[model samples]
Target: MNKVFKYTSIALLGVTLAGCSTVPLTGRKQLSLVSDSQIEQQAAASYKEFLGSSKTKVITGTSNAALVKKVGNNIAAAVNRYLSSQGLANQYNFNWEFNLIQSDEVNAWCMPGGKVAVYSGILPITLNETGLATVMGHEIAHAIAKHSAEQMSNQMLLQTGGQIVGAVTADQSMAVRSGVNLLYGVGGQIGMLKYSRSNESEADRLGLIFMAMAGYNPGEAVKFWERMSNGKASGTPEFLSTHPSDARRISDIQKLIPEAQKYYKK
Candidate 1:
């Protein structure tokens, strides 16, 4: 049994090392057990299902919808230009599409391969073209950074660790196994939350640069986030939340403006 545990630990360590990857621009190391093609395949299926479903009302043939596409395309083009310049263009093969959904959710999201959706509710908060670009750039950054794949990889690792724990504890009492599993589950959730916050921060940073490169003022990001913070309900603390505190995010964006401005063309 000791030999089995030793071998398993060594194997797991090797896999962890092999899976380590650096996030673009941020240079943050992340686990990437899944391939980009796999993520894109899943995203394509999910995006189709979402758009086809009755739960979502996609708005089209309107000025607002056009604006969403315009801003999304600008950011996407800028990101592609950067990737090409870095000789990483082959890393992504995006079939970009942007849609506006009629909802009051005050949110937007982008999937792998540049599938994007913006909620009408968020437009009021965005308030202008620059603000809209701020939101789109951030969401697009999440995809460009491959955050979804990183998250999936983290979950895979956590599950594998749990299975290893269970195997090693096979001789223990059922109560002991259950207790250990419970503790592991709690720890996994906390770890996931931390990763999510980190992803959001990275997205914010990358988005600022992308918007600037796309000819949008990076300074608008601070204003957009401030509006979001005002609308947020008083709930979980920053440590427990899956996003940075409003003040912290605003301050960070302010500091990043100069760096992003370097990429600005106008």
Candidate 2:
């Protein structure tokens, strides 16, 4: 039994090392025990199902919806260009899509693969285009950094070692399908992909740069975050669950602005 445990630990370490990957732009290394394409395919299907469900009211033909798409596309294009320049375009084949959902959720999220949903309730807080860009840029940065995949990978690592090793080695996609299911529900009920505080801070850093790349001023993110901080409440805004709005976060965003300004578009 001792020898068996030792070998299993060795095997797990090997898999962990083999699965290492670096996040784009931030250049942070992450473990990737699951397939990226598989997660994206799942997200696309979940996104379509959510859109088609009767519970989902997809707003369109209005300026708000149009603005969501515009902001999303601009950031996507800028991000794609950056990836291409970095020779990482092939690693990420995201079919970007954006939608505005008619819900008073006061939240927005970007799933794996470039699928984005902006809830109408957050519009008042956003106030204007630059504010909207701040929201979208931050949410999309979560996807670009593959935070979801990293979370799932960390979960996989936490499972019983022998079972996890077998599952990882035998069939990665099938083994992790449950993780996707846990994060998403096809009936227009999205289980929030609540990330760690570290992930949120990283997303903020990347988001500022992304918004700047899309021609929105990175400094505006501070104001948006300030508004969010002032309006913090209990258990209502889904955004706050994963994203804690406070003075420290705002300070961190302020600190990151100088680096992001380097990528500012005219």
Candidate 3:
């Protein structure tokens, strides 16, 4: 009886190990070490902490602010529809919120579980509603793609044994927190917050599709990217500095235009 139990446990472990897989849309194979529920709990907690630390300015009745929210919400809805059609709707189970920050840094990001912030500083670069949609779509796409979770999970796999990827008991979560600080580029943290070039390209392509599906003209992406490239050459935009170089990003986006155009609503 003891021998039978040992062999059965070994077989179960083998099956679980073999089942690690990749996500759709990005096609980057994942270690699948962490369960979705576990990650969601962690992400939700982290997101709340982030919000608490942030000094938020609620945008009220302003044209620019309203436009951004309108476009952002539209993109979010489109992303939900896309996920639902793919039979993956249950993955995002949080209340999504979008807000504009009255700041002078051309920056934006979506936290895990769909907390999005767009800075007023980026408005000039966006130029119009379509351009704003392009930026918001791209940022929101990162959340939809589960890039943050993948990034965190990859760090865990690297630190812990990949064979026991999903086995981070509560005792090990403290060590994982140290890695998170480094991953997020907190000053004095050991690791660099370097995003791979492939991830950047994927975001650009997927972002383009999301914007188009949300009723913005896909061709606007090309022009918007061109303006972005020019802005970088003239002087680096704060947002573009950490991103892939303008030439590389623009070329990649141009290549993705036809596919994005297919999803264009008008």
Candidate 4:
């Protein structure tokens, strides 16, 4: 058993090293054992199902909705342009879609293939177009950075038995597979919130640049996060939480502003 464990550990380390990839902008190395197509296919289907079943109405033809779409598209475009210039265009093949869902969740997220949803509850906190851009940019940065896939890959590594079961059950019924995927995806989102401080910080930094490239002021990110921090509900302490403290996050953003400003058009 000891010998077997040693071999398994070595094998896993080899696999991890073989699958490592650098995150754009941040230059951080990350595990990416799963293919982008695989993750995106799952995300697309899951996102569709979520919209279909949830107490959700897609907001359109309204000023707020238009702003959301505009900001999302701008950020997506800027990221695409940057990727293309870096010769990493093939790394991103997103069927980008942005929507505003009528919910009071104080949250927004972007799935693997650029499926973005913004909750109505967050709008009050966002306050204006730049604030909206800050949130959207950060969320979009998560997708572009492939944070979800990285998390899933990490889970597969840490949960070898569960990964084996998942592979074996891949041929199960659509209903069963969808159910599992949906549950896992939701759990992954929560897990993302609870174990992604470095990912969040990287997103914040990249988000500042993306928003600036999209023509929004990067400085607004500091103000937006301050509002979020001030309005935060009672929860875990910042040190123990998955996110950096608001003050720390704001200070980091301030430091990145000079670099991000170079991308600002206006």
Candidate 5:
């Protein structure tokens, strides 16, 4: 390799080490090459646009809609309480919002900044409040763990050839914005990287703990995933497609329930 490129690679490796942040509860180090506040702002705009767009039908004033908000808030409160207890609350500046959207796509997601949406189609699979809590908690875990930003940072690092110290400080790129939109199935619908399997596992573990802290039985998550596994549909639900529900995932969640139970109380 040329001297310039070789030195640049070494510099990038140093930055990579210095730029790592730990995922709470999981203690896994992840890249932190981007700004959380910037990503949250972009996500907020995309979420607002998604809500305001003509094709979107946001359900309101119904029992199900209320339930969605309730579960989201409960999980958010649990997460916040846990973070605050750890003196890590200041690290997470989440302005939580939850809405039930009218779609038969069987999907739900939580964007960075605690913006959450639940598709009406998933309700049948969720069945009840605990089930909804399972879903919301899992999605919220993604935000809490900063999975989206981590993915974006890794992408930026790749695209900029490890010059992210400068790139991340610049205005958010269209690529980043597209990623935020894609998380919600909003714009372009391309090039967004899915969370890694380890990230998925972290979400499952933290989700169960969050749900348990919110007074839901973590064991319910197993049954919820079972229903998701058994459901018949015309095609793969967006939830399962992104989430990868399989025997191993279900078994891993089962193994995590005991850990989650420590936070549980009647």
Candidate 6:
């Protein structure tokens, strides 16, 4: 009787878990135990915390930061317009905000709900509005694709024997601890190197489409990456880590350009 109950429970759990999801643009089916709202809440909190801890440098003068914001908002508008056309507009509750931080880290990211940060450092490599659009589009693509929720779902499935499900719950404390640990592991193992390669490529593909749709030239993507690679050669060892180089990545991006061109407004 006990054995029967245990086996039956496991089977039921497995069946429920089988309803995984596949990301758009890249058909990677993932175990998504978390919801968009949950991810949005988490992202909002973290974004606020990071803003508190990190010094933010707002660009007001006729500087690169101003250019980045202009480009980023254009891309964001395009994304929203596209999502609306696809009948999935409700998926994003975007309150778009772009901030330029005074960091030489050559890094930028978009949190789940359209909070974006571009370091002053990456601007040199980005070079111009078109280059900045490429980077912003890629980061925003990650958010629109709901990668964070997908990652949380993966962790939940692994940790809870498929018992834990959904985004919000009575498991706040547990979820917080687990989420922090999961993010650390994801950043170190997935985001930084090996695992993120596929995600990076997918972002590039979608980013190109988004930027082109926003009226930016898709051709500039190749040159932007080349500049990035030149910078990488001297910076921290992202090569020793993972991610394709300028040449290899540009080749892949070029292959996707024909498809992206279809979405280009000009």
Q: What is the C-alpha RMSD of each candidate to the true structure, in Å?
A: 2.3, 8.0, 8.7, 7.8, 8.1, 7.7
lDDT of 6 by residue, 1-31 (tens): 2333365447547844775766665667755
Record all residue pairs in model 3 with backbone atoms less than 3 Å apart, i.e. clashing: 33-166
Q: Against the true structure, candidate 6 has what lDDT?
A: 0.74
- In terms of lDDT, the best-performing candidate is 1
Per-residue lDDT of model 3, residues 198-252, tens digit only = 5566778889999988899877887877876676453654233446678878878
Ranked by TM-score, the better of candidates 1 and 2 is 1
Weakest 10 consecutive residues, lDDT, candidate 1? Answer: 1-10
Residue-pair clashes, model 3: 1
Deviation in Å, model 6, residue 243 alpha carbon: 2.9
What lDDT is reached at residue 206 by model 5? 94
What are the lDDT scores of the predictions, listed in order?
A: 0.89, 0.83, 0.70, 0.84, 0.83, 0.74
Q: Which has the better lDDT: candidate 1, or candidate 3?
A: 1
* Runs with alpha carbons beyond 4 Å of true place in candidate 3: 1-21, 35-54, 161-195, 231-242
Model 3 sits at a Cα RMSD from the real structure of 8.7
C-alpha positional error of residue 221 in candidate 1 after TM-score superposition, expressed in Å:
1.2
Which of 1 and 4 is ahead in lDDT? 1
